[model samples]
Each structure stands twice: as C-alpha cells, then as structure tokens.
Target: MFWLPLLIVAWVATGLSCTRLCLTAYRAARPGATPGQGHELTLYEAAFLSGGPTRVTDLTLVSMARARRLLLAHTGWATVVDPVGGDDMERSVLGAIGPGGQSPIAPVRRAAAGTDAMRALADRLVTAGLALPEGTWSGVAGAVRQVRAAAAAVIALGAVALLMPAQESRGEAHVALWFTLALALNAGCLAVARFEIHPYPRWASPAGQLLLSALPARGGSDLTAVAVRGTRALSDPELRAAFAHQDTAHRSH
Candidate 1:
C-alpha cells in the first residue's frame, strides 16, 4: 500500500493540470463583446493581432527605416532621420530613442511595446473582438506548460512506485501495472490537449487568428513582408543584421 500514496499524488497532479488547461482553453475561445463585422485591420493592427506588441514594434521600426524616416544600422542602433512620427506607434518608438535621436534598437523595441499607444491598440482590438484581452493567450500557454510538467511528474511518480518495495502479496509488476494506468491517463489527456490546443496563440484570439489568416499573402513590398513575417522579412541586409544584432544583444542580457 506504500505505492498508494504516490498513486494518489500522481492522479491529483493529473487532475489539477488537466482541469486548468481545459478551463484556460475554454476561456480563451469564449466570444468577445460586439464581434467584428468585417472590420479591416490596419497594418499596425494586423501586426499586433498576428504577433502581439513586439511584432507591432518591429513592423513600425521596419516601416520607418524603409521610408528613410529612421536609420537602422548594422550595429543595432536606430537613428531618427525624419524627426517626425507618422503615428502613435512611431511616436512611441521615437520617444524610446530619446531626443538625442539615436538609441539601441533592443531597448527601443521593448520600450515601445509597453507604451500607452500599444496598450490603446490592444484595447481597440479587444473592443473590436478581433483580439483577446491582454494575457489570455499567455494564460492558456502557461496552463499548457503546467500540464506538460504534470505529465512528467506522473512518469516520475510511476517510476518511483515501481521501484519501491513490494507488499507481501503484490509484486513489482502488479504495482507497475497499476501505475501504468495513471501514466495512460496522463498520456491520453496530454494527447487530447495537444490535438485540440497545441501551438497556442501568443496574443490573438480565435477571431483574430482568422483575420490574420485571411490577410493577403506577402508580396510586392518590404513593409508587407515585415508586417507578416516580422523583421526577418526585411530585404535590406543591413536592416536584417541590425535587428539580428539587437536580438542577440537582448538575449545576452
């Protein structure tokens, strides 16, 4: 009966993790107020829906750089050429770059993404039903991760149960068979969750995802490519190098 305690713990973990995942998924898929009625997403909006605030910041930087309004050096510094921002996002980026007109791209991206303008953009998308509220996608993703951890814990517990001393009547094989049932439960739950909710969205809701999918395929413009595929879509090698350098620097921190 010593293995019974471990079995209880395994089942408890499985139940809690799976329940959290299911709830998170259900909340994420719930309908928003005033669903969008063929509302067209602007490039900025599209970028946000497709990849969240960081993507919006990336698109803005790329567009400004391409238009010669901003200079993106291969060394990861951004220089303001035009001095005037065309929109709120651009203004936020400019503000992040500071009045001196030059700043590192990594800090600029992070700063801009947390600006009031970005929050307003998220609010607009949520109101329009094209995007989920902030953190919904993150919640689902977190829940999924918890479930994965639970699955691993179940496997470990099962192994421990099999390794423990057997009772007078029960054998190691018998204990393993019982623990296998718990393992099967964990496996089945994980499999179902993967099938139904794998590849969780980073920001967009189901509606936003649909809108993103419906966007025209990338073609004919560097801005369009950046809007869809992010900074890597920039055709300018220096710009690509600049962003890559920024990413490397940011990760190093």
Candidate 2:
C-alpha cells in the first residue's frame, strides 16, 4: 500500500542513520589503527587522557597537597602554602585558587578545568594520539545513543505498519516480504550499534586501550600512589570529589 512504501522509507532512513552512528562510534573508539610508538605520557597527561580534565585536576590537587604547596583542607577549601608552580598545569590550578590564593575546592576545580593551559595540554596529548579529541568523544557518545534509539523507533513503526488492521487482510503475499525485511533491517542495525559502542571513561584507540590496561601505576612516594592507582583507576578520595565539581568549568573545544 501507499503507507507501506512510506514505512519502508522510514525504515531505510533510520537504518542509514544507524549505520552512520555505528561508524562514528567506531572511529571515536578507535581513532587510529596504529598506536603511538612509545607510551611516554606523564602521569597527569595519562590521567587527563584517560579521564579528561577532571582527572587532571584531581592529580594536580593531590600533588600539591602532597607536596605541601597547597593545603587541601578536609573542609573543602584550598589554601596555597606556596604560590610557585612548576608547570602551566600547576599554575592553572593555582590560578583557580584565585588571586587570594584560597578558595573552595569546587570553584577552584571549575576554574582549573576552564584554563587555556588545560586545552593546550589536552591538545598535546591528542597530538601524541594518547587522548580522544573532546568533540569527537561527545559526538560519538551522542551518535551511539541516537542510533540505539532509532533502532527502537524504526522497529516500532515497522511493527505498526505490518500489524495494522488493513495489513491483516492483505494475506501472506507482501506481508512476508515487507515485514521480514523491515524486521531484519532494524535487528541488524540494533546489533551493530550495540557492538560499536565504546567505553565511557575516555577516548582511546583499541590498541591504546589495550596498552592503557597494561600500563602500570605512577609510582613514587605515597602521594603518587594516592593520586593515580593505575592507568584505569583514580586513588585519591579528594581527587574523586574534584570530578564531581567539574560541571562548572572545563571547556572542551
């Protein structure tokens, strides 16, 4: 019927969209086929690429607190014991503490996450193929979700088209052809979409992901041990809290 063609069109459109989504997810999940020759990322860089700006700030706060350069009071305030910083990231963190050199952890985290220095650092990591570009990661995640939702929508529409009262009397002739094709299309899209979804932690190619899993924790005194447990986990409770505070800042471009 006329409606059958329209439903078929809808199904085809959705199937095509789903395919695009799957491709995007795959590209984001595995940005490149080849991983960097050497895994030489600094602890902070690894944390940033693995977990984004939030993790970077976490490492910074923990490092400063451990080094006695900043006091991360248990009461959620940061007081700079020393104003000097060794790098741009550290300086960004100190600036986040504000001109007074003291502020609540949440505001400080927000500010630090928003700094140009953070973007430069993130870009450097991406250039080394250690991190996923921010836009690419967000696009992939959104596309993955859209594809999944489209799968369901197309299936529902196809089901309605097939099971309609008018279609019931149409016999097994076209019903089998149209219905089966629609169902197959929807099912295939859904299955592929599921398989293409990537990990939510951060962007890493498949090879880099494997390497990240195999990478060891940053080892030093108790401080390094506390900030980074390993490539996969964050060790410090305070640092973890900093993640909760990141929605306020941390621009991505």
Candidate 3:
C-alpha cells in the first residue's frame, strides 16, 4: 500500500525522537557527587546557579555600586570608583570595564560573563554536582525540541497518508487509525516528559535547585534578593533604570 511507506516513516521518527529524549533526560539527572555537609552557596555561586553568568555579573555590579566601589549611572554607564576587585568575579567585571575605568554596562556584562572566571565557576559547580555539566541542559532541551518536531512530522505524514489513493481494499479510515497510533505514542511521550523531565534548567541541576529553594527568602534590595532575583530586586529606581537601559541597549545590538 502507498500509505504503508508514510506510516513506516512516521513510526521511525517517533521512536527515534522519543528514545533520544529519554536518554538525554537520564544523563542530565545523573548527579556527579554530593556536596559537603552543611555547605552553603556563596552569593556568586548562588547567582550563577540561579541565573547563570549574566546574573553573576549583575550581582557584582549592584553589590559594588551599593558599596560605592562602582557607580552604575542611570545613563547606563559603569564607572569604576575602586579599581580593586574583591573576588575573581569582581575582577572579571572590573577588567571588562577596561583601564579607562568607564564603559557601557551592556558590553561589560557580556564580556564578564564570557571570561575564564565564568568557566571556572561552572567547572566548580559541575564538580560539586550543583550544576549540570556544560551543555547537559541544552542537550535535554534540544531532545525535547526534536520530539516536538517529530510529533509535527507524524501529523503531516498522517495527513499525506489519508490523501494518497489506496492501492488495496483497506479504507482511508484504516490508514488513519494506524497513523493515529503513532501520533498517540508521540503525544504520550511528550506528556510524560513534561511531567518527569521538563522545566529544563538553564544552569543549576537538581541538587542546586534544592539548595536554592532552601535559602531563606530575602526581599527588597537585599543583596541575596538581587543575587536570586536579578536586577528586579533592586529597590533603587536609578539602579533598575541603569540595568534596564543596559538590557535595551544590548538587545538593540
């Protein structure tokens, strides 16, 4: 039957895509090692796990601005009032601002996030099982996207199968029923994945998420709040405006 070939293709695509998603989920969930007992994440580590390197950069900038070591003007310019960096992350941000001691906040954020310091931070988190290894979250997210594409392909193939003239006595309804089985399999796999493996982390792993959740909640300009919630936690309108302007400037580029 002409529809048979299309049905075979649909089934093959569904099986392969679903299998890949399952494998990716399994690998992402495998924790490397348990962190030491009573360990707590530093503000930098918390920022990285909560929102990645960009968040870390934002925290450093806000922290320094509050301490008067750096100035984040509402005009979106960052001026280094204190050249000395308190830590590696701080030093990275300082370097991004350059020897002139002034730079645009947007480019500084991007440059700081891409530095060797960020890589080292990621490596440390991965080693402690607090964050997924590089690309693991992306791998799972990619697998999920592939499964979605396969589901769409199955639907398209099923429609084509229904349109094709039957060379045998079997009706169009029978062909459709066969195709429906493949479609159902794809849908069921996606539903299961949504519950079991979805909400893929952009940074932190399961262990890291647990730690994040355990942290005492802070609000309104608290450094921890800014670290956990990004610039939104900033109580200062000027600080928020600076970061907001920085974000708009970055997106425009």
Candidate 4:
C-alpha cells in the first residue's frame, strides 16, 4: 500500500512527460494546411538544415579551398588567397577568416556560426519551415534519457517495496509486478521514440529533409554542389583530413 502511491505517481509523471514531448515534436513536424511553398533549398541551405551551422561552415571552407581562394593547410590553418568576397555568405566566411586572412579553421567555424548574417540565415530557414526549431533534437534526446532513468527509478522503488518488513501479502507482490509492467511500457516508449527520431535530421524540418532527398545528386560539373554537399563529399584527402581533425578537436571538448 505504501509503495503503490509512489509507483503510480512516478509512472504517471514519466508517461505524461514522454507523451507530451512526442506530441509536441510531431505537431511541429506535421505539414501545415497550406503546405510549404516547395522552395528549392540551395546547397548551403540544405547543408545547414541537415547538419546545422557546422556543416555549412565546413562546406564553405572546403569550397573556398577548392576554388583556390583559401589555402587550407595540412596543419589545419586557413589562409585566405582572396580578400574580396563575391557575396554576403562569402563575405561572412571571409570575415570569419579574419582581416589578416588567416586563422585556424576551427576558430573560423565558431566565428562564422556566431556572425549576425549567419543568425539571419538561420532565422530565414526557420521562418520558411525548412529548418527545425533550435534545440529540438537535444530536447527529444533528453526526454528519451529521462524516461529511461524513470524506468530505472521505478525498478528501485519496487525493490525497496519488496525488502520492507511487512506481513507477506499478494497485494504487495502485485505492486512489484506492476513495476515490471511499467518497465516494459518504458521499453516500448523508448523503441517508438528511437524509430521516430532516427529519420529526423538534426537541423532540418521533415519537409526540408524530403526535398533534400529528392534533389539531384551532385554532379562533376556542378561547382556550387561541392560547397553545399560538404567536405566529406570532397575527393581531396588533405581537405577531408583538415575537417576531420577539426571535428576530432571539437569532440574532445
């Protein structure tokens, strides 16, 4: 009897939390009544939507290096070969590179992501419904972890109930078994969440993802494709290495 209230409260609270988050994310992703404008997202926009600002930054660096406007050294430093930016995004990338036209690529990336222009681009993408709301992925992931932790807590509560000094009763045994049911339900919730989120991109809205997938694959003659497609798509080992090293340095933090 003592443990019943505890078990009911814990399971109910966790269930409600998970359900609410799942519903909110789903509603946010669902297409609107009027539908999207079917706008063709540019490569940089696609990269930003799919992988966030980091992907766009990497693509920009790679594109500049390929065009001989920037020298991406084996040592991970980016030296600007061209001080004149052709457009606003290029100017932002160049500015992030610095007035001296040389700095470590990692810092350039951080600086670029923080730029006012970059923030504006992000706002445009969200307004167009091409990008996920900021923090959605992390929030969903956190909810999953919270539910799993609640499952564990429920088990602990059940164990404590079983170990308490009391007259042996079927009612007490039922309460513990009920905890097992709660654990099983938690497992089901986790499975569903995983399935739902696996196809959901980190920064792109579901509509954006669909369009990105339907876009023509990068071709040999598409100069713009290389920048938007990302550094991983590059054939140059050194360029990929520079980006890889930067990625590693970030992960270590």
Number of the top-ranking candidate, with TM-score as the measure: 3
TM-score-wise, the better of 1 and 3 is 3
TM-score of each: 0.90, 0.77, 0.94, 0.86
Model 4 residue 224 CA deviation (Å) reads 7.1
TM-score rank order: 3, 1, 4, 2
Worst ten-residue run, lDDT, model 4? Answer: 218-227
Worst 10 residues of 2 by lDDT: 244-253
- Which number leads on lDDT? 3
For model 3, the superposed segments whose C-alpha errors exceed 4 Å read 217-221
Instruction: Candidate 1: count the clashes.
Output: 0
Clashing pairs in 4: none
Query: lDDT tens string, model 2, 70-184?
Result: 8765455778999999888899999888889888776776788889988898777677666676677677667656666666665666666656546456554565466556556
CA lDDT of each candidate? 0.81, 0.64, 0.87, 0.73
Which residue pairs in model 1 clash with each other? none
Residues 1-253 of candidate 1: C-alpha lDDT, one tens digit per residue:
7888998898888889888888888877765554546666688988888778888888988888879999999999999999889888889999989999999988887788889999999998888777887777778888878878887887898888777888747588787776677667767766776676567666677777776776664333667667767888777899899999989988999
Order the candidate numbers by lDDT, best to worst. Answer: 3, 1, 4, 2
Q: Give the TM-score of candidate 1.
A: 0.90
Enumerate residue pairs that collide in model 3.
none
| Per-candidate count of clashing residue pairs (backbone under 3 Å) | 0, 0, 0, 0
